[model samples]
Target: MSGLSAALLELRRTLDQEMFPLKVGDTASDRHALKELAGQLDDYLLPRLAALDAPLLAVVGGSTGAGKSTLVNSLVGAEVTEAGVLRPTTLAPTLVVHPADAGWFSGTRVLPGLPRSTGGGRAEAGTLRLVTAETVPSGLALLDAPDIDSVVKANRDLAAQLLAAADLWLFCTTAARYADDVPWGFLRRARDRSTALAVILQRVPAEASGPVGRDLRRLLEENGLGPVPLFEIPELRLPENGALLPETAAGPVRRWLEELSADARTRAAVVHRTLAGSIDSLDARVRGLADSVERQRLGARELADLAESAYTAGLTAFDDGMRDGSLLRSEVLARWQDFVGTGDLMRGLESRVGRLRDRVVAAFTGRPLAERELTAAMANGVEALIGAVADGAAERTVDAWLATPAGRALLEDEDVAQAGRLGRASPRLQAGAERAVREWQGFVLDLVRREGASRRGAARAASFGVNGLGLLLMVGVFASTGGLSGLEIGIAGGTGVVGQKLLEAVFGDQAVRRLTGEARSDLAERVRVLLAQDRGRFTVLLSPTLEADPGRLRAVAGTIRAHRGELSGGGAK
Candidate 1:
């Protein structure tokens, strides 16, 4: 193969592999058009240009019952192609080549996607049948394609595929159907590609030919197709052989085709004109596809950003819930009050100090049942706050996703919207909070033991007992610095004062403050990890879209567009 042919093959492979996975319906470009263009490149343009000197192929295309097959047979002076009244008589395309040029059409020079078949057997489906007729001129081949507007979808697609392979289009339409939209749609396409073309107005009534021809000519000229030669095949009678009338009826059409076939330069010019125009259109078409790819990337990225924002809101809301003193009301407040009465703890701060210390020590050491009850209430309160924040985040994320095109696609699956619902508290959350609280309790006891080892307060620490002192510290941590303000602030602070006085008795005021700060920081760190785990649920929903990077796709398209001329066999201008 030549350098140009190899380049074209590589380009075809590249087009076959290119994909844009994101589909945003409202803002999405027509992907079907991109697919059709790629099909044409692989089935027609690339293969044809690879062997540029092959026989000029003219595809006979028209609306249903337009007599394209009859014309093909008449031009070749034989009944080589089938013609009938069935809605789509030409289910499979038939290619007629001069006996001398049979090798050219029989080989895979163009339309390589369709399997080649020899006679008419098994040609009812998508196959091309090759036929040879001695009378047809050697330099040209004619393919009778299915009706452009056939009711059968496969026929319509096959018609378009055959037309794309043509170096010239010999369009046939009747006087009655000539002005129809469907046939003109194809003529407009031929004009856009600068394909060499001629039209035959078959079954024309002699009386209406003059006026109808003039009107049709006017329409053609208006549409930039005035230069195309028009031939008239008057309504003629078919003989017993089912063959067309004598040579006189088709003489002019035949002579024109023969003249084209006899001139090698004219045939080459026709092939080159269509080939170059098709190749040059590649960059713009691919650029359109590339732009669609960018829209997909943008849409997917926006969805990921929305998920991140939703989770960030959850984290912020959870932080506010912890410090607002809202969780310390009702059951939690009742338990704390029962364990240490509110009146005496707040009033006897400086006065009656010995009585307050004894009462605080008795609350810690003597009432194991009250300590367990307060701990249970605090854990349940923290768990409930965490669950509410997670639910709010899930709802927010779903609402935002439903508003976007890409998000709508995701929401089509009911499970995706529900994926973020943290439902009941996970076992992991309950176990994690429990473990952190236990560790902090242990840390408080160690603090007392270390500090009491060298002080006069050592005897006081022994009476308070590590278990009681540790539970007291746990209550003080809940009445965190930020968690104390207003009336509730005074109440929670009063509780803190009881715990603080007890600890300060054993370890001095400065040591007690430092121990509280360290214990609070450790608990916060554990809670931070728990919140991060919850955020992962939303991220999981967006994983597939985020992983498919459109940048690589756009880069590939850009590379192909920039080098398309070199890739498409030098056909690019």
Candidate 2:
């Protein structure tokens, strides 16, 4: 018994660890079932197993106005439970126990989730009101549950909970209401659970009782409930007090209860049958819930995959834009032309090699317009490229996500959709990109100063060398490769070579190549870092729907299978 209890406890613990929010489609039913299963385990199964000798509780439940409360009152031979013509006569559940069995229910031994109270006091409507009747047998108790199809939502829910906690269900319904769809639904569930149940066909006309009883039996047999007991209470004149006609009118049901309560072994068999059946049903129900969790995980992964593919395309597009010489056009082209005069400086550098510094300083000092414009054009080109890539990536990610079910759910929240627009870098991204560029430019300036350190006192190297050489290094980094025979290569490479020679005249060939290589590598690294940071915007948006680990669900299934014998009664506990 302890081992079975521990296994059931472990199952409840495993279920509690799951979060089955209805964010995923097709999950609401599974979520509701999961909650109900957990409640049954806590309120009934484990508690009942711990105290197998506890009194048997037979909950009388059925469709609205099906004479459930009336049947309960007559079974105990007293008005222990309220019965009247009000729409929902019993708003709260009333448990009718014998005087000797009062202590069993008053404590937190069963249905502990509901607070226990005595009758005729100011108890909340949700409380379980206990009523002791001497006519009721000591070894058994009867609970008058709310109408299964009550108009009030709370009453309807409470009815299902009470039924799930019952050792046996004395399902009561009228001749007129037995064939109703609602009552049959509960009957079908009871059949599936293999619960101990007996139908009480109440308020039947004497002339129609034979036909109605046969028809009800056929329906029960067809629905996998062939051998379940069926007793009839025909229409008869009630006493002035509105109680049942007499003990003879309630003959069969009263006799069954008396026999069930009198025989201790019979009562234990009923409890064992219901308890074992409920435990056996857990594997399928728990598997259903675990499958629902897996579906949620799959939905999340689908959304994440969409985001990943879209952003990866964006990254590819950005890399292509940088390598295809697209940034060398428009204002940037005009600035480079103005700075070096269509490659004239490279053509004359070898002829005027000795006087290079004097001419370079004079040209730079007299007109710094080309140099300033070139630096501005480079910054503008890089910024525009980055912004366009960011926007394209954001748009693609949003579109892909919108096409999916999970994505549509997320987009329903206007704020999440608004946050997904990545057309421009955020303030933080823009600041970081700009700072990286500025730092790379500083690295170039340092290289120039270091190369010119041999000629420390030279005025040209100190004044314009750092700024002029750094701008040339920026232009060189924009050139794709030195092997192209096209006009773009000449225009871009010509500007780069002019910078190379001027620096070589001041330093030497080896230092010039090494310095430019180092500076260009530094700039490339900075741009890559900035773009990677911008990619994080898409990742952040997709984080909520990421797939969770499925190992916990597998572990739960494994544990249930390991203890199947004890739970299913193949071996005694």
Candidate 3:
């Protein structure tokens, strides 16, 4: 493929993958615009650019009951498309082309997304009916599109798609509904895209034609469509057979279309003009989509930051609980005191290091009941702290998300919120917290084993065993005197000092400090990891939106803009 085609193809791929899943600013409109741009690329720009020599497709589109099907039938002098009292007279769009031009419409060159049906009784949904008519000029084809204002959403969407695919739009509206907002909206779109257009004012009384036509023309001019052709078909009675309109009524439009078709240059001009306009319109439209992508990216970032902040605070809270002598209270304190006779240990902990060492050795060498209880108590305390921190983080993150529209939408999504998954901690978090604590305790035991590798250290460690030393290390971590105050100094602080001094006597003071610091750091690191897992629930929801790169979209738009001249010259052949 040529560079321009390759670039356009890349643009199409980008748009196809682009997402505005978040409920940010005007997201609904952004999604609609995205669909419209992608549809035009598939149904019109890419196909028409590939085959510019093909017949000019003039799609007849307008409000419901606007007589678009009747106008098309009258112009072709046959009922190739259905017309009736039904609200949506045309269910499936009908494309009328001369027998010589049947090959162009029969294939998948244009409107390829829609299925093609030749033997059309009534075309199925999303099917295009092809009808060959000798009355249609070879170089020009007319498509009778569904009502633009149909009550059926699919019909309205299909109408817009068909109109976007047209090289020329034959917008039909009755004189009475000429000023309606719906048709005017389409006319404005035609004006913006610079699509070649002609307005058919059907069902006009001769006397009212002048005033209505002038008013419609003025509205067109105000909407930047002043140069568009206007055809007025005066209201006239049809035959009993509900046949085509009188020749005089449809003659002007019929003659104009035929003359345009006979002149190859005119047909080419119409195709080229619409093609140029469509390509030129892409830069702004794509850039607008890029802006929406950026908004989604920013919104995702904001939610992620909120989650991160909540988890970070949770980590800080865990750290604070560890140091503030909080874990040293209640059951943990009672177990530690029971493991080492606290009454004597605390009273003389500061003065008698040697005696304390002997007492620690004797206590650890006995039956392992006290050691097991003390270790279990420490594990439970740590697990509880972690569980509380995770719960707080989950709650904070949920509350923060609920404050934002986009975040709330994601949290409320059925996939995210089913069974209330997003509003609280994961069901497995309690088990995860327990597992993490056990893992950290194992790490402390490993640290004790490694530290005891030296002959002298091993001799001292054997007196207490690795399990006893590991339990002492856990006590040192929780009962740190750094954040204690008041009565805590006498209770949790004194308890920690006993554990610290006992460790010092076993392994010199410096080693004891080093071991305590390592144990604390390891436990903190484990809690950090646990909190991060809890935070993942929120960030994962934002991942898809965050992955949409605005820069890629802008780059594609820039590439298209750089090739504007080439694109205007009818793209790469």
Candidate 4:
């Protein structure tokens, strides 16, 4: 009994070191493998400890024809069990339990996968029997488990499970089945778990005894099987084709069983040995499954990086669209040559209203050229400039993006369709230009017409002085710069410099020189206002975002500075 107690304590110690913190149930595939191993240990071991008030059990487990029933009958000193039965000797496990305890038998029927129980003598059909025996040792029980490698599938599974719950296992195998793969596979499983195991080499054939013993030892050593206590029972004499093992050598088998199950010390040792080893085995299986679970956790980081990559792609598409709108500058530029050219443009403009002050002084100057002629010329000139600029910029913009790898990659390599912003067909800019042209043109004309109507209010007023301040008085009519004809105004700012040319075309430069240079300064001032009013709206929209990252935004700022240079250049840069 002391040996049994010590063995059981040792088993508990082993379990604490290896599988104390077992977690079980409610996990998916890879995790479920670990969970199941832990569950088996808990289910088997926890119940045993809780039933400590019940007698200790030694579960005899082994493969078919290993003489397990023969060994059991020998230990009990009676022909109490059938052997070599075609129906299988132990269809259900028979328990030799303490007689007075009806507690273990009361609700045993509800237990899962276990067979039915009837009385204290025999377990019912489809169940293991619990029998009471007085000489069965105080606080001790023994189970004759089904053959682990039985032909019946359920029996095989039941045997393996019973092995897990066992406090002590009598591992019986004949010399013939000793090295069999299926039995050894279970042996290995038990070995890793440190299950308390005592091997029985039963019924050795006389001819192959010596060689087989050596081979078995060698195989056991290679597999890390412990120096488990071994009990060898020689083949006993029997009638040919007999139904039972002919009895002999019952003494040795009984002594070992008593050592394992009878006295308190030996029983405790058996208990300790079995449980400690089983915990170690359980830990290993669970740990292996845990490693697989960890590999899956690492995949989440990859998913996050993929999201950031998508954002970068979107920003790139937006940048390309901005560049596309820049091409409309080419539309504006197309008018550049024509607006800057030598023509009757200045002469014609001066002839219409160049002498407005003098004409007003002469009574009919208040009525200038009709709105239709002025409107027609301005529209034709702006269209020509826009068409020419749009054509030149279309191809160049694509090439510019292709000039460097970054820009080329932005234009040609990406999923541009996903970005959906257009570089070529940007209506914002065309709209901005077309819109600016219509807005400011109408504004200027309305100013001229209103002033014309005001003067007509006084039909007899002597002179219409072309006041340089007239441009300022015109601003009250419109809401935003989008209403301005900024494109034409931008092209004509250069033409504004040729005041001498304007005077010559209208009144002959010779005649103008005869008057004061002070008069020419007055003319220049009006032209300056015309130039400013034309460009005021477009300039306001071109500023940069203050919140953007400095290094990235620097390029946008650089583009703006270069376009500003466009205003400063004599058209070369």
On lDDT, the leading prediction is 3
Candidate 1: tens digits of C-alpha lDDT, residues 1-573: 544444445555655543444446533244565667777777667767667778889999999998888888888887778888777788889999988888876766678778888875437579889998888888899999999999999899889878878888999998889999998888898888778899988888989889888988998999999989998888877764337645777889889989888898888778888876676666566666655656666777787688668767876776676556666766787787666544444455545546655666667656777777877787677667666665666677778877876776666656554533433334465566666556655676676667677678877777776666676666666664465555566656656666778777778788877877776676566666675665566556556545544454455545555555553455432
Off by over 4 Å in 4: 1-39, 51-54, 78-82, 85-90, 100-116, 119-126, 237-247, 295-573
Candidate 1 Cα misplacement greater than 4 A, ranges = 1-29, 77-81, 97-109, 115-118, 129-141, 239-246, 258-264, 325-388, 413-573
What tens-digit string does per-residue lDDT give for candidate 3 at 1-573? 556667788999988764788999999999999999999989998888777798999999999988888888888887788888878788899999999999987878889888899864778878999999888888999999999999999999999999999999998899889898888888888888889999888899989988998998898888888888898888877764337888888899999999989999998888888988888888889999999999999998999999999999999999999888788877876776677654554566465555655565677776478788888888898888888888888988889988999988887887676425556777888898889899999999998888888538678677678898888888888776566565556767655666677677678788888888898898899889888888887787888888888899899988877776775454467
- Which run of 10 residues does model 2 get worst, by summed lDDT? 541-550
Q: Which ten residues in a row have the lowest lDDT in candidate 4?
A: 471-480
312 Cα displacement, candidate 3 (Å): 0.6
Model 2 lDDT, full chain set = 0.74
Q: Which of candidates 1 and 2 is the stronger one according to TM-score?
A: 2
- Candidate 4 structure quality by residue, lDDT tens digits, 102-209: 355434421234654645443444576656665455565567888887888878866776777766678888887888888788778777777767777888877777
Better of 1 and 3 by lDDT: 3
- Summarize candidate 2's per-residue lDDT along 1-573 as a digit string, tens digits: 556677778777766754453267666687788779988998788888888889998999998887887788777777777777878878889998999999999988889889888967434689999989998988999999999999999998899999999999999889988899988898888877778999988889989989999999999999999899998888876765447646776777988988998999899889888887887777778777767777777776676667667656666765566656667766776787666544454454445434433454455554578788888888777777766676676677667766776666666666665544453455576677667766777788887777777664346566665778677556655655433445556555554555566666666677767876787667666766676676577556555434333466566656756775664453434
How does each model score on TM-score?
0.70, 0.76, 0.92, 0.44
Query: Positional deviation of 177 in candidate 4, in angstroms?
Result: 1.6
lDDT (CA) per prediction: 0.72, 0.74, 0.84, 0.47
Who wins the TM-score comparison? 3
